[model samples]
Target: MERALKRYWPIFILPTLLAFLIGFIVPFVQGLYLSFCQFTTVNNAKWVGLSNYIKVFKDTTFTDAMKFTIAFTVVSVILINVLGFAIALALTRKLAGTNIFRTVFFMPNLIGGIVLGYIWQILINCVLSIVGEPLLALNTQAGYWGMIILTCWQQIGYMMIIYIAGLQNIPDDLIEAAQIDGASSWTTLWRIKLPMVMPSITICMFLSLTNGFKLFDQNLALTAGEPYHSTEMLAYNIYNTFYARAGAQWKGIGQAKAVIFCIIVVAISMIQLKATRSKEVQQ
Candidate 1:
């Protein structure tokens, strides 16, 4: 059976491999090439060399978006993971209605990002209006915090579920041994549960980090980079550069921005994965 499975593995994998190459790899390679060319369409690309990349750096909007995105991602990742882990810890206890609570928490994640954004926008605006405060789009600080709240509300539940799974998978015997050894709850958690749950921590951190960086639809629906693009994130900034503007040069510049965006996300995600995975326990 093992020999037959091994021999047929390539056959099973071939279709998916071909689809990946056609769907992702081919387009990615073409995009990397087009980033160096000026073209309104793929068929009419004219080599422009490093001009697009140079323009990308010169664009202050792009720089502001990069800064805003980095700040948002950092805050959102920390809040989502910490809150999710805390909620997971609470729910894992022999609490009443645990399943119901989990379902309630996770339901927000099932909502579309655009829908969540609009819903939060309305809700926040209503509250602000009641208090005579400026609307989300009119206030830079409000817009920033609005995105953070929207991201955390949508993501914390998903991270909580992962944390719950990790907590549940801890060996009962190991926990019992810690208690039997006169270990305090905090010590047991820090020494045993944390190390044991490092795998989930790694997965949750990776997802949160990437999601924060790649965020677009929510940004579009929520603030739309209002108050002079001060709240714009990198993804939304690229979208504006790509589709919201005109001309072949803009297209080339957008492509270049996309390539740079891809590199930033890939680099940060790799660093986060490496950092988290290093702390993960073997079990």
Candidate 2:
């Protein structure tokens, strides 16, 4: 049986592998090549070396988008993880209607990003209208905070579920031992629960970080990089460069920006994994 299973494993995996190659690797290679070429279409691509990359660096909108994206990612990652963990802790306690609360909190995550964006847009605009301030589309600061709030609201519940799973896995005996040793609640959390939950923390942080960086549909539907493109994020910037702008050169530049964006996300995710995994305590 073992021999048959091992022999058939590749057969079982071949279809998915072929699909991955066709769906991802092929297009990725094509995109990498196109990043160095100027063309309106793949068939007409003409290699221009690193000129597209150079143009990407020189684009002020790209730089601004990069800065804004980094700031937003940092804020959203922190808020989502912290708030999610906090809620998980609360919900795990001896509280009434905990399941109901969990369901309510998690429902937002089920909504599509574009739908969430439009819904939040109307909600935010209504609030600003009541306050007699400029709408989200016209106010850069408002747009930034609105995105932050929207991201946190959508992600916190998902993270909470992960945290709850992690927290529940912590042995009751270990917690009792901590309390028996006169450890305060805060001490138990800081020293025991946190370390035990490090794996979940790593997962949640990676998701939040990457989602923050790759955000697009929400950014588009929410602010549309309005008020002179001050709120444009890196993903939106790449999209604008590729589709919104005219000319073949812009396409190549957008491709280069996308390649750079991919590299940035991979590098940052690697760094985050390394940092978080180091602190993870093996159970």
Candidate 3:
């Protein structure tokens, strides 16, 4: 069986490899090249060297977007993980209708991002109208908090499912032993459950971090970076730079921003994984 599997490995892998190269690798390499050149299209690219990178740094809007995105990611990551884990702990207990509750909580995540954004926009606007702020786009703070709330609502359920799985995988004897040893519920959670769930934490954190960074559709539909682009995120900023601006130079600058964005996300994700994985206990 092993020999037969080995013989057919290339046959199984070749199509996926070819698809990946064609869909991702080739375009990525081309994008990197285009970042160094000014062009409206691939055929007419003119080499412009480091000027695009320089322009990216000099753009105040891009810097603002970076700051906004980082702030949002940090807040959203904390809220989603903590709330999700707490909900997971609750649901894993011998609660009534646990499956129904899980299904309802997770339903928000299944909704499209654009649809969620519009739904929240109208809901928030209505609430704010009672206090005289009729539109979310007009208030920068409202837009910021609205995005955070919307993200947390959508993501917590998914993270909760991961945490629930982790909790279930933990040996029942360990928890029972802790209780027999006179450990309080808090002590058992902190010293037993949380440590055992570090692997789930790592996975949930990585997903939340990346999703927060890459948020675009919600940002577009919710506030559209209104009130002078105060709520613009890095992804939306790059999109606007590429499509909203006229002239070919903006495309090169946009590509450079994208490359920088990719590097930042990759570096942060690697660091987060290393940090979290170190604390994970082997089952």
**Local distance difference test scores for all models:** 0.95, 0.97, 0.96
Clashing pairs for predicted structure model 1, backbone only: none
Off by over 4 Å in 2: none
| Quality of model 3 by C-alpha lDDT | 0.96
What is the TM-score of candidate 1?
Answer: 0.97
Candidate 2 vs. true structure, TM-score = 0.98
Candidate 3 Cα errors over 4 Å, as ranges: none
- RMSD (Cα, Å) of model 2: 0.8
> Candidate 1: lDDT of 137?
77
Per-candidate clash tally: 0, 0, 0
Q: Per-residue lDDT for 93 in model 2?
A: 97
Candidate 3 global TM-score: 0.99
lDDT of 1 by residue, 1-283 (tens): 9999999999999999999999999999999999999999999999999999999999999999999999999999999999999999999998999999999999999999999999999998998899999998798998999999999999999999999999999999999999999999999999999999999999999999999999999999999999899999999999999898988899999999999999999999999889988998886
Q: Is candidate 1 or candidate 3 better by TM-score?
A: 3
**For residue 172, what is the lDDT in candidate 1?**
97
Q: Quick one: best lDDT, which candidate?
A: 2
> 93, model 2: CA deviation in Å?
0.9
